[model samples]
Target: MLEIRPSCERCDKDLDPLSDGAMICTYECTWCRDCAEVLGSCPNCGGEMVQRPIPSAARLAQDPPSTVRVFNPDLMAPTSD
Candidate 1:
């Protein structure tokens, strides 16, 4: 089952389970569409970003979305070699 993470990993924006603005990578790293557009790809993994599917209300009721927030601001921070 897709984890349906609650917020964007990059910007910490709240992404409701029913929100169409939620974007995710193959690894299930979630992000908002705006951040995904600006980054052009997943920062955690060099994978394509695609709109996440909104689960049906019934499904949501059966299997609730994750409440955990994953914020890693330094995931994209500049690294000195």
Candidate 2:
């Protein structure tokens, strides 16, 4: 199951569950479209942003789970040589 996060890691902007602005990497690190654009790409792995899957209201009604996930952006920072 995709853990749809609630907010962007960089700016902490709210990410709508159905928003096309939500972007993710292979690691499932989530970001908003603006952050992804300004950052030039996924800072963690250079992955491109794509539309996230939104759960239908029917599906959500069956079992509601928190959309928010804990992600530390600092951990994604590149190490200095």
Full-model lDDT for every candidate: 0.90, 0.73
Worst 10 residues of 1 by lDDT: 72-81
lDDT per residue for candidate 2 within 43-62, as digits (tens), equals: 67778667677788777677
Model 1, 24-54: lDDT tens per residue?
9999999999888888878778999999999
RMSD of 1: 2.7
The pairs that clash in candidate 1 are none
The TM-score of candidate 2 is 0.69
Give the best candidate by lDDT: 1
- Cα TM-score of candidate 1: 0.89
